[model samples]
Target: MKKEFSGRVHFVGIGGIGMSALAQHLVHCGYAVSGSDRQVNEQTEKLQKIGVKVHYGHSEQNVKGACLVVRTSAVTPDNCEVAFAQKNNIPVLLREQLLGEIFDAFKQRIAVCGTHGKTTVTAMIHHVLERCGVSHTAFIGGEYNKSNYFFGENIVVAEACEYNRSFLNLHPTICLCLNVEYDHPDCYKNFADVQKAFSALFSQSEKVILPSELQKMCDKAVLFGKNGSVQAKNVHVGRGTTFSLYSDGVFACKCRLKVCGRHNVHNALAVFAVAKLLQLPLLQVSQALAIFCGVDRRWTLHPECKFNVVCDYAHHPTEIAEAVQTALSMCKGRVFCVFQPHTYSRTKAFWQQFVTCFDGAQEVIYLPIFAAREKPQKGVSSFRLAQLARQTGLNAKYFSTFGKTAQHLSKTVKANDTILLIGAGDVNNLTKFL
Candidate 1:
């Protein structure tokens, strides 16, 4: 199907980050875009401001007179609009299929994919391109500089998600594969199933860039990490991070980032490798890297709070550990972690890992799990998680709601203490109480 289409295009679950970005892109291209969601939020409001018609709730009529209907993976076939579209013989497309078409239109396409850090790395690349005055379009997974969709010239930079093997849809000119790990248990049966998807991605791409550890996955890939083709050595992490970047065994330049963490150091290295492949100016790239603040909810700092409070989207076990460590490294006082598990399947898959991840936190406050699209699983819950954590010798407590959690923190937390609100769901809303 053609990327460019006439007539109205409707999106089911348009409030989603990826869906909103795509809708924004289509609107910019002059297509009549409409979308439906259960409720109006930031994404829908932004679309409304830009003249994209939005419906509050889904209905059969919502899909009427549309050239095509695009639905997020969460939207089942039984959805009213989706059913209507099919009954009326209208073409229906998955979100990723449409994204792939849009991506295919670009002459220079970069698709960044991994279990973690895709959003930050994608945004970093966007900043580099913007700083260099390169004409490019970017679809970031999270809001960067307060926007997820940036329209520019032909070059396209997109955050490729691995869930449901969605990243396989877009055939990119350059595929930046960050470290791969087991995730999306609902989609993949095992770790090897996850690796198989990345291998397929490497096979279809013209160029592949990865960390030194994953070099064995792709023979033609360029490597980044310690002792790789591109490296960030002598790392220093505080309010921010600085490192010496070396490319192909030669010193390239010193890089500094406003974002703190060794994970971000690896993220920057991936960006540097992409810059090198694109033949961008290293000096300018380093400067751009220094100035990039970071994406929203990825260690987002709330200065209004009496104490330092950080809001982060770290749901996976590996991510939780890294985020807690990053918080511990920067805070002079005790670190208090307020965690909400993202999905039941994930929590059940990595139960032990989750219990042990908050090793260094002064206290772990657990909220109800965010069951995004899954029903509650037996023997999998935040309460059990807290119990396991306590058994592990970590101070852990379970709060059934946001109010109680906030109340406990307000009484116990003191000056200089840091509160970390960590999750992938609505748990971030706890920030209003803090």
Candidate 2:
């Protein structure tokens, strides 16, 4: 397909995973790409290596001579580059708007959307499609193995995040909604608001893949779950989940995965449904899923030390509860959780749920909230969360710094104990020290 946009494209906050993936795809599609980020990171460096001019700091000068400026949701209206683009009459697009334009170029575009597991499910679908020799492109949410964006032909598989109703911007041929819960308190008022946004996205999709649990949400959807159109039966959960997939009440194939958790089984089920819908060989799809190691931070285990460390990008209450439960299920020893709340709004919004999410952990270490795109709220803090957890009969402790947290863990964590670093923030940085 011909590239949609011509001339130079500048991305504001290009260091973000989603923004960088779009920039990478645009560069691959033959657009002259230049971007500026607040700080240089691996993503920015990768962009520079791939010939995208990456400026270290945001400035009006960064967007000079650019035909279009793409700004991430985190980028504010007063951001220098965004303001300059508007003032100078350069076309400005939101991150999702550009993604929607890119989606238009593909005939078999699959968008995986959910409050959780979007990254894993999108990456899984991409892997299966690639293994089946289906030419495809994917814009993954997390850095899976090495690259987040894979350039190919025909099909495009991408993670559709629901935050700020961004996924609604995409009109995919195939859409998968793993599950939904109330999240992104800043953008969504409640669960009903979240469901309304997803309902809009589902309505626009040509074919929707959803869980049987959410069958009531969409009437004409290809559902996957215990009682869905595509079902996983005889499931066995261990170091990873192994199950048999049945398509339309008929036995299809048995599959195994290296990625742990029952949640992952549902994620793989969505991928299987996509494969079946696309008419890919079931055996090949199962093979690809079995060998799939997982995205970068989704139950990523480091086994070099006495106590193994598992890192995950699970920040929401449901995700946190699942991560802790999954770690408990796989580990033979005690499961310790080092959790860093992602944002102040989320922490404040889900405070009660967050307190109960750490039920399965043997000991919980609470790190300060990351506060990515929001300023800290007056009464919302990790210390308060820890206090709540302690009140609920949890062995919880709060540490102000990662170094002190690591020190405490080193002293307390015994051999064979599994430390699960859980969050979407820099809590993963503590893994290196451990």
Which candidate number maximizes TM-score?
1
Per-residue accuracy of model 2 over 1-434 as CA lDDT, tens digit each: 33355689999999999899999988887889999987889999999999999898887888889999999888898998899999999999999888888886788889999888999998898888888888889999888769899999889998888988888878889999999999999999899999999999999999998998898888889888878778888999987688988988999988898988888888888888888889988888999998998999888887764568999999998998989888888888899899899999999998988888988788998999999989979989999899998988999999999889888989988877899999999887886788
**C-alpha TM-score for every candidate:** 0.98, 0.97
lDDT tens digits, residues 1-434, model 1? 25556799999999999999999999888899999999989999999999988999889988889999999999999998999999999899999999998998899999999999999999999999999999999999899988999999979999889999998998999999888999999999999999999999999999999898888999999888866778887889888799888888888898889998989999989998999999998889999999999999999998876667999999998999999999898998999999999999999999899888987999999899899989999989999999988898989999999999989999999898999999999987888888
* Weakest 10 consecutive residues of candidate 1 by summed lDDT: 1-10
List pairs with backbone clashes in candidate 2. Answer: none
Q: Can you give the lDDT of residue 63 in candidate 2?
A: 88
